[model samples]
Structures are given as structure tokens and as C-alpha cells.
Target chain A: MVDVTAPPLSPTDRSTVRRHRDRQRADRAELHAVLDEALVAHVGRVVDGEPVVLPTLHARVGETLYLHGSSGAASLRGDEPVCVTVTIIDGLVYARRWFTQSANYRSAVVRGHARRVTDRDEALAAMRALVRQVAPGQEDHADPPSRKEMAATSIVALDLTEASVKARTGPPGDGDAVAAGDDRWAGVVGLATRVTGVTTCPALPEGTPVPAHVPTG
Target chain B: MVDVTAPPLSPTDRSTVRRHRDRQRADRAELHAVLDEALVAHVGRVVDGEPVVLPTLHARVGETLYLHGSSGAASLRGDEPVCVTVTIIDGLVYARRWFTQSANYRSAVVRGHARRVTDRDEALAAMRALVRQVAPGQEDHADPPSRKEMAATSIVALDLTEASVKARTGPPGDGDAVAAGDDRWAGVVGLATRVTGVTTCPALPEGTPVPAHVPTG
Candidate 1:
């Protein structure tokens, strides 16, 4: 519903960080990058005057983020304000001082009132996009959602008009005193989500090789 | 301050899931496992009447979750209600039908009003636990937080009373129709947080070997 096309990264009143403003990435491209790399997002919504955060799969189609869950899901049902966050932890920063220790990560937060997709055509397209984002090339291979399946699922579309992206990369920025002292090691241990192996279903005939598109390390 | 020691997983008014109740893990040990494996938590707080979620390093100390941030961080400053969620994406489930696709993940959510830890000793211990959780042996090598550093950091503790843990592992549970048709691969691609390498600080002396505890694939 919100038209945010190539808009400059302008922080809204809520998006501004009171601390660590240096780490805030105001570039719109940065927000897109974080959303693209993430397969799941933690969505926060107010339930009964209390905040509830739930993890769910998400996909970005242009300026809108589509989050799908069972139609019966209480959190995704109503048209309420929601905050979706995607975080990619890149590494752990080991600092010389305990207070300075931190994680190297790229995170994006989008705040908007979710609009449940009701148009059948739009819902199908959003579902396809979600499939493509999670497992590339599978949309064409897998059967499309049936009428019953479509009716049973709820897809909420959130516009990226108001969003914030913050990232901290590279080595730990030790303080002057810790940098001067050379008693211990100080660096980053790179962390990544690696596809260790592909597992075929037991129902599948034996020797069915994993498709090339399936990610495998 | 909530004493929820190994109580039965009674669904709080806000913690009940209307969809996919089978995925909910009721055991307290399951909650602890998810918290232990997670390095970061997406913390949600109501800021200016809008839900805001931020990613931060977190450590578990028995029944409490300690989240530290810059004392100046507006989101961490107040004793407002907060919801902290830890999610671990274990794999990507490839189902035969697009509608059945889901991620294999373990997620835990804790909802409570954050209590700012002003006690110097408790704050110090929390900081040390945080350091040890992220980079195990590094805590022994690194200097403790100085008085100024301690004063600059803010630690918020959330009790584990009203919490929910949900996990979905193993293969994709395709419907009867989808399972009967075996044209495409149907299983989960195991994903893991792999330590690709360690980037040591240039400040270190020449030829300083990477520490053994520093994770390396």
C-alpha cells in the first residue's frame, strides 16, 4: 500500500538509533541486501497490549515483503502494525575488553501495518516469489498451490517504506588502552550459514541425486 | 524476578499458537537448548507506541536472559515491556508442493518487562557471561570491563516465565497427494553455522597463531 520506490534511506522518528548511530546503514540498497540474504524474519506484533515476536519465512518482491503463515495463525490474522526484522550474523568480534565484545551482523527492520493479501492472483504471485526466494528454481518444479491450499494460507504484505539497516563488520574496535596492551589475541571469527549436505526423502527412489540447484557444500 | 523453574508449558494468553501447535516444544530444556545455541536475539520493544526490533548479543544465566547495549540506546534504556526471540535456522525444507514448504528452525520467545541491571557486580557478571558465551576462552584472556566501560553499558534482564519454544526438524511433511507424487526432491538441506576462518588483529605481533578455541572449519 505504501509506495517506496528507490526512495532515499530517510530514518523515521522510530527508525533512528539513539546509540551507535555510526553503525546505521541509511542506504536503501543495504536494506534490500539484508532482506535478500535472510530466509526467515522475526515479526513483532502487539497482541492484547503486549508485544509478541514470532519467526516466519519471508520473501521480498520489489518494495514489499510478503510473510506467509497458516491462515489459522493468530499472530498473522488481523490487520495490525508489525515490525519485521532480518539479521545475518557474520561473525563474533572478540575484543580486548569484555564491554567491547560484540557480534558482526547485518540487520534490517521494517515497520508497517500488514495488509493481508486477498486478491487471488496477487496471493499466488507472492507465494511463487516466496518459493523462489527460499529454494531457487523450485517454483517451476513444484506444483502450484491448490484452491484448498491457497485458502488455508495467509500472506501478509508489508511495504518497505519505513525501514532501518545497521551493520558492523571487520575486526573488533578495541579501545586505546586495550589496543596498546598485547597480552591476548583480538579478532573476529567469521561465522556463516553453510549448506552442509542435501538429504533426499526416503519416499524418493534410491540414487535420486540432489538437484544441481539445491545448495550443498 | 519471575521464578519459573521447570514448570509445565502452560500457554499464557499471549503465548498460545493457533496454528501448528504440534511444533511447539514444551520442555524447559528445549528452551535452554535454543537459547544456548543462539548468539544473537532479536529484541522487540514498544518505542513511541510503535514496535521496534533490534538485534543484540545475548547470554543466558540460568532462568534469566541478559541483553546488553550502549547505555545511550533508547530501546534498552527504559524498563518497558520487551520480547526477546532466539531463532536458529537448521535447514531448508523442500516439499513437493509450494504451499507445504517451510524452514527447519528452532525458535524461543521470552516476553517480560526488562529490568535494567544497575548493580555493578551483577552487571559485571552478566558481561562476563556474555563474553564467555560468544568466545569461550577469550574471557580468560581479555581484561574485565573498566569502571568507565561498565558505566557506559546497559544490561537488561528478562525472566523466562512467559516463554514459548517451537521447533520443526527432520524432513518436510508433505500432504498425501504431494507425497504420492515423487517427481521432485523432498527433504531438508542441513544448514549449520560454520566458522569459515579467523581474522586476527594486525595489532598482534607478527606470526601470532590463531587461538585454538577460535572456531575454524
Candidate 2:
């Protein structure tokens, strides 16, 4: 339905998709939705002339994206050119042929220099957003970070100025094969991220009531 | 329980995890397990010196991992250095403090020069593997790709030679806070990839008997 075609939004050439331009969504809201729906992001940066990609938890606050990592993590330090991408696998498309078989997915790719959040207030807000991003009401239930804990955590913020979203939806791409009288079965097997269960900590008392804020199966 | 800390399998200096050594799993099996369980992977490569990461479909065959893309996708062309990373979020950990809150996840990172699959047999095998990876029984159900279809597809093989896996499980990291008499509730909200539904192609007549192989909600 993204007609840049009507939702036109990407500013940079590199952020735009060359192939399957039809799947590209330039809407800023579409960009934010892709980042917010997923729990993890694959962060990449050139390390010694080679690209290194690592998966980490991410949170989005308006145009800013914050990635969570350890203070000792080398990739998270310093302002460096980076790419952060998140994908939500919607379904597996079983088409008439292997070439046409595909997955229905929504993915967002953000490229920019990542800067460590140095200001205490900004860092505090980002930290709260990170916790809330993963488990909504749990942010209020969890204690605020202590001074020592903050020292051990690293929060790097990357602006979402240059970003693009690509998504493929609906049935198999080769419906014409059926029109050609191919009897082969074709359909989509949907996939989703689900909460399987809530397991309490062993150290906590056995009857420790499961918090209402936590997602349960 | 990956004890190199016992499974010690990383051969290169960069593949080793400097932080959270306890979470790094060196077993080859662990790396394979992480790749097989996830439906999508984030592929990263250096483009004009800045790193670029995009999500795509992938299938693993023994020591080789195959990434599928359109023939026109520039990033998938030529032999280039890449980092393929996949993350399976096991659960959301709600800890006593924001600092201690974390995700229970298993992730794998593989780095190598991806070479195009030119040989027809290898390409065909990789294509079948790719289909089966997403939906097991569909490989047999779907028709094999024709010559023109093969020309429009690209399969790149990257060796699993340089790779590492990291996983975190069990209760929250801060059980001592409970011992300190903090009334805050803390536990794990498990997450999993699930099949939500099956939708047949719209072009095909409705009430077409659903196949047995596709995963369903």
C-alpha cells in the first residue's frame, strides 16, 4: 500500500532499496513501527576493515534509537558509522516453485554514526525506554538503576534520520501459476513472536506471585 | 554449561567474546542450533567503508550457510566479507533493577567471504534447503525452479568457520535483591516463534484442502 510511490520518506541513496523497490516504505511512522515491534536489532560496524554484526536489545524514543550493551563491549564505545536493522518475520510463503517461495516480513534498516549517551538525563530516559521497550509495565515495577549499575551499562544512541522499511505481505507471489493450471498447493504459514510462559526466579520464594505486568503464555 | 569455559571452539581472535565470557558457547552444535531455530537473519557487509545490514532468508547446510536473495540485489553480488547474525529471544527478563534487567536469548554470529553459488547442483540443493528451512514439508510439495527462475535468484555460501554463539538462560541476574527484602516482583516472560495461521492463495478457489506440512497456529 506504500505507493514513494505515496509514503515517500528516505533521504539518503544508500538507505533506499535498489531491488524490490515496491516493498520499500518511506513513511516515518512505518520506520518507527518496525523498530518498536521487534525485541532485538542486528548492529553492524566496520571492525579492522571487516564488518562485524552483533545482536542486541534496542529501544526507540522518537527519532532516536538506543542499543543496550555492556560497558566492556568494544563495539558499543565511541561514535562510529553503524547500521541497525530489525526484522519481524510474518509468515512463510509456500509458493508453486522454489524460486517464488518467500517469507512475508517487515524489516527496517537504519544507518548512521552511533554516539554514546553521555548526558545523565538523556541516558536515564534512554535506559527507562529500553526497559519499557521489552516489557511495558515492568519498567515501573523494576527499581531504577543504581550508580554502580549505570557505570557497568553502555547506552549508545543512533538517530533515525536515514532509514528505510521494506515489507512483503499477502499470499504467494506466483498466483499466476495456479491460473496456468498447476495443481500444486500454495499458501502462507504465518509466524509470530509469542509469550510461552512466565518462570519465577528460583531464589525468590516458591509462591512469589507472577507480576501482572509480565507477559504470560 | 558451555564449559571452553568447556566447548572452546573459536579459532580466530575476533570470534572470541571478551565480555560475558560465561555466555559464549564454543560448541559447533550451539552455533548450528541458533541458526536453525530462527526464521530470518541479519546480513551485514561494508559498503563504501560504512557497514550496511539487511535482513534476509538463510539456510545452513553442514559447514556452509546459504543466504538467498534476488539476483539484482547489489549487496549479494561478488565475493565480499560479511557478518551473518541471528538472534532467538528466549524471554524477557524482568529483574529487580533496570540495570539488571536483560533478555534471555541465544545468538550466533558468523563472519566470512560469501561466494556466489554458481554450480547448478549446489544451487539447486541450496534452494531446496532454503525452502525446507522455513517450512519443512514444503520443499517436496513445491515444484523445482526452472532455468529462468534459477537465473533470477542468487545463493551465496558462507563458511561457518569463524563463528560464535552466546546464550543467557534461567532466573534474573539479581536474586540477591530479593534476599535484601525488596518487594519488587521479578521473573522471566518467555518468548517463542509460533505459527499463527494458514492462508491459501486468494487466486486459488476457497476451501482448497489445507496441506499437512505447513505449520499452523
CAPRI-wise, candidate 1 is medium
Candidate 2 stretches with Cα past 4 Å from truth are: A1-8, B1-8
Query: Could you give candidate 1's per-residue lDDT for residues A1-217 as a string of tens digits?
Result: 6435687664577677566788888788899989999988999887666677888888998899999855664667637799999999999998887877888999888998889899999899999989988899788877899999999888999999989888888777873543556657788899998998888776777777777778877
lDDT per residue for candidate 2 within B85-150, as digits (tens), equals 999999999888898889999999999999999999999999999989888988898888889888
Q: What fraction of the native alpha-carbon contacts across the interface, defined at 8 angstroms, is recovered by model 2?
A: 0.93
TM-score of each: 0.94, 0.95
Please state what fraction of the native interface contacts candidate 1 reproduces: 0.78
Docking class for model 2 is medium
Candidate 1: which stretches are off by over 4 Å? Answer: A1-4, A175-179, B1-4, B175-181
